[model samples]
Target chain A: MAEIMSLSEAVTANVNDGDTVALEGFTHLIPFAAGHEIIRQGRKDLTLVRMTPDVVYDQLIGAGCARKLVFSWGGNPGVGSLHRFRDAVEHDWPSALEIEEHSHAGMAARYVAGASGLPFGVLRGYVGTDLPKHTDTIAAITCPFTGEQLTAVPALRPDVTVIHAQQADRHGNVGLWGIRGVQKEAVMSAQRSIVTVEEIVDELNPRVTVMLPSWVVTAVAEVPSGAHPSYAHGYYERDNAFYQAWEDISRERDSFDAWIDRHIRNTRDFSEHLALVREEGVVMA
Target chain B: MTATLDPPSTKATTDEIMTVVAARELKDGVVCFVGIGLPSTAANLARHMHAPNAVLIYESGTIGAKPTRPPLSIGDGELADTADCVVSVPEIFSYWLQAGRVDVGFLGAAQLDRYGNINTTVVGDYDHPKVRLPGAGGAPEIAASAKQTFLLLRQTPRAFVEQLDFRTSVGNAEGGSSRSSLGMTGAGPAVVITDIGVLRPDPQTGEFVLTALHPGRTVDEAVAATGWPLRVSDDLTVTGPPTAEEISALRALTGA
Candidate 1:
């Protein structure tokens, strides 16, 4: 059975230093609240994983929480480069960061393989590609049935997997919809999982794309607007303005630190963060 | 730059021409594994134009995403609401993409070689890159699995290189028999639609050669812009300017 806890409690209880963690979301339902809580707790030397690491990951990297990032793509969406990520790589302002990059397909397969309790995932990829040159995890294996050579990457079994969803029932069965990335697989692949939901209801509407039964989930935290900036399917719209604003906020070291200090470090929870954003008159939507 | 003897009927940007040229290549009802940005614009334009039934597959697991506007990124939630089906990411790659269900795979590149192999990984040294571009997303699998692939990029000496800094996606591997010997079933990079012209691989050599030029561009200019000793078609054809209908539909889709 899964326990219902506060976001801080969930992060404090679940996430630890030097753990391999995956905060999975495609472009929507990103676990920003959970990431903020992890930052608030100041967990260091963590390995962070995601398909696309945007503003949230940049913030975490800037705050000196992550020692490594395993991702396919890292950018600021329609805006531009992630300055903090660039700084960490180029100048090592906060710390020297390591990266293990993979394609979206590769990461997807690895997650699936991990969920299935397999040792590695296979795909018809990385042939004549430079990804194999940089990443040691990728290797070639011939298929047993067809004898065709295929690329293989080891299954990603994270220590803790965090995801944000639309809702969860009283029984701790979480439901999520819209641009469903590898949330389900990530949750199942990790040894421990934390799901931050917008609300807890008696009966979760059956329109969800995928659902996780109570037994597989470790903890469910009710953090409304958990996926702000990144939208929840039914709860809110994507804050394009914030995404646009983040370019400036994340560009310079001083501004980035100041913004994180004002918004995340100063706030206790997501609600307080939203209040700060509102008070600062930074339009969200 | 030599001025064209006959200008295009309507005012259109180079990016617009590139999109139209790429859009025309997509056939009706064909499933395209589309990358976000330029590919998405072209695919959506195709859906709004001649290929009304064309399907757009995004890596975010949205199959047949019919967005009202061009999505900002692959993970845009609007893609899901407007899509016909949304599956898990693993299912999207394993079942749909690697299963060889995709018909046309559209991609853009930071760098490309004469053989149409792409390099989105790095610009300089692999360990210490001069410019670190976004690494391969799904391009490697799309290049290997799709029945055919279409490359959309702004042609430049820097991008269209003799040799890539890193090959992130294979076009024809090295040359003829290379892809086949490697057991890659898909015909890699059938068409490369650039800002100035269209290039297709030589049947025997698998080298991308300029087959057609857009209305305002010249063959000599195209050759000059390419880093390799680009070959021109013996009987080069000029691609017709974007039709008003195509332009109107593109404008409607993009709202630009």
Candidate 2:
């Protein structure tokens, strides 16, 4: 069982530079409040692992919190283009770590392979394609038996994994409920785990804890509205205006730091990020 | 009652094979965690067919996704446009899957073993693994949480094998209820769909025993294509041939 900690404390204590931390959330839901806490703490040299993020990741990287990024796709392109990500991509900062672009399955499978202590997670999607170019961050090789060339995705063992849930207790035994076991891979790969949740519970019995309880989840914190506009999937509703605003800001590289300064760096609470959303109003869940 | 060996009624060109396999997994009212390629195709086909209500969720957070066709990968715009909602990857896992809401998770593997141990890695050892493979997306959770997992592969010696270089996702390790004791929180697989028909784990040994063969297929063909020696049930059943309605509808759907 982990000790009860505050949001601010967990963020500052666990996250470190050059740590390959798996940030929770996908494009918008469950906007990894823990990751936000990390950004606020000004943690740097972080490399994120994921297929995509709405703007949270872009904000983190733009704020100079992230030094390396890996995944199949990083930006929203023209529509909700990840502007800060693009700037970082096109020399926003000098020499960021490898920006890999492998298939989504391939990326997650590697992480799973690592967590399971397996050799490789076979993938058929990228077979005989240029997708191999992007996956070279791990590299590729030929099969000794058939001489068939295959992408070699090395094991992914994250130093820390920060996740969010619908509910959890001090020991970090979490229950995400339904349609949200997305962080299972990160949980599998991490050396240490921290679960941030909407509310704290008294007892997370084995009968109710969604994923297994035995994993060494180091700590827990109460985040009530952790996934405000970004929702916790079934628990809350989508914060479209926030996503829309994030998409718009991610369009131009001109105001990268200014955007973060006005939205994040200048704020102490959540409303400030929404104030820039242009909707004039965003109700926190 | 239908005698086998219906000749090669179009073995399915590679792309077509991809589409056929994809369409085979379509269903209605099922919740799916979608990825690109075979999984995407199958999920989309499910939506297009009777399973219009079938919801597709991507690791990127797009949910109730109804992509018109397969996205190049996870980032394709099709996923966004067709989705009923979108959230973070973590939410997709924590809330939807780990929470136990999703039903079927469509997966494509590089190689598979008798126990459903997948090798997405190489052909050799780990340290200097012979061929490094792509990593897992959300498949592990899909395998663990979905009511049951649906795997779609064209099938060949290289794919259907004796041993997977690596075990990317856990299927029926050591078979039976042993996984439960090992703390596997997710539901074990109920079935495995393949080009040859379908395979189910034996009741006692957990070794794969062939349950059915595609229309006209013989045991010899399936075993010949398998990389390792295969198994069969004493009372093997013949798999139904793709109905004309199925073939035509499938072809038109896939556009191959």
Candidate 3:
């Protein structure tokens, strides 16, 4: 059963150096607080896995916490390039970083295979693309029944998976709705899991579309507005302006370092970080 | 640039024409797997104007999303709020997309070859790229699995290349039946709508040939913009200018 713990405690207890960690969210309900906690804790050599490595991954990559990234897409969503990610890949500013890339279908299949306790997942993908040339994890497999060719990707079994959700009942059952991306599969695919929720409630809302029965999770933390800059569907709207501002803030190495130092490292927690960003007029009130 | 000989009163920009022309390709009630940017705008415009029953699927797992405004990102709350239902990422790719439920996969590209293969991964060497692009997200599979694909990108010598730095998605390999030989479920890119004109794969060669030029655009301009030795259809025609309704609806949807 999941033990209710503080975000710091959860990070300390679960995440370790050189671990293959996955913080999964498509674009909504990203575990920004948890990512920040990992950064604050100064974990190193993590093999970060996410489908879309959004700005949070950018931050982790920039902070030199990640030695490698396993993802499908790495961008700032509607905004342009993730400058920090670009920097790390192109110049290796703080340190050299390695990347193992795949298409969204391949990554998703790998997660599903991991969750299903399968050795690999098969799909009709990467036929004429050069992705297979670059990624060793992708290979051709023939169907036993049809003798037809298909692509097989190995299961993505992570050491830990972290996600942010709307609520977790006192029993530690996590419930979330609205654009539920791969969080369930990610949790199931990991040896350990952390869920940071907006609030801990007496009972989970019945309307919640996806639920984790607490047994699958290792720990839960209540960190309201945990998906800030991202969104929580019902609780708040996406701070698109912050995403846009990130383009400028993350463009330069010094500016990004200063921002991270002031906001994430120095702040007591996610709430404090959110408050400081808002107070400094970095985000809307 | 040559001035339009018969300028319409509505005065639609080339981008508007490109979007309008692309939107017209979507048949009523078709399921479209949409990429962000121009493809999303065109798909949404089609939903609002002609194909009201059209299904717009984003990679974020929002199926049948009917957003009032064009979403800034695939996972914007508006998409989820207005979706028929939301599934997990794995299910979206497997059960919906790879299952062949999607009829049209609309996409955008950073670079493309004459065979319609895309390059959104990198602009230079894979190890040391001059410009690293957002790598293949869902395009490779969408191009391989969606019954047909529609590509949208501005035409430029740099983009319409003879050789891609990296082929992120397959259209028609080597301009022949090679794509089919690979056992792909879907016919690769059917149409490539650009700022200058519309290009369709030749029935015989599978090479994308200039089939129609938008109003005021000339064959010379299209050829100049392409890096390869461009081919023009023998019976090439001019595309009609965007109607007043199309211009207005597109503007309203984009809020531009």
Task: Tell me, by lDDT, which candidate is best.
Answer: 3
- Between the candidate structures 1 and 2, which one is better when assessed by TM-score? 1
For all candidates in order, the CA lDDT equals 0.89, 0.62, 0.93
lDDT of 2 by residue, A50-110 (tens): 6654366777777777777766545432233465665565554523544555545556656
Pairing residues by index, what is the TM-score of model 2?
Answer: 0.54
Q: State which candidate, 1 or 2, has the greater DockQ.
A: 1
lDDT for residue A265 in candidate 2, whole number 0-100: 65
In candidate 3, the residue pairs with backbone N, CA or C atoms under 3 Å apart (3 or more residues apart, or in different chains) clash, namely: none
Name the lDDT of candidate 2: 0.62
**Sort order, DockQ high to low:** 3, 1, 2
Ranking by TM-score: 3, 1, 2
lDDT of 2 by residue, B1-256 (tens): 2223334744444444445545656677888876566667666765665577888877776788666656544534456556787554445665777667878777777788787756543456533434444444455556666667767676689889886665656777667666454444555565566777677778666667778777666899888878877888888886545544555555555565
The model with the greater lDDT, 2 or 3, is 3
lDDT of 3 by residue, B66-169 (tens): 99989999999999989999898999999999999999999999999999999999988999988878899999999999999999999999999999999999
Query: Which of candidates 1 and 2 is the stronger one according to lDDT?
Result: 1
Using Cα atoms, each model's DockQ against the true complex is 0.66, 0.05, 0.83
Report the lDDT tens digits of candidate 1 across residue range A111-204: 9999999999988887777788789999999899988788899999999999999999999999988888999999999999999999999999
Docking class of 3: high
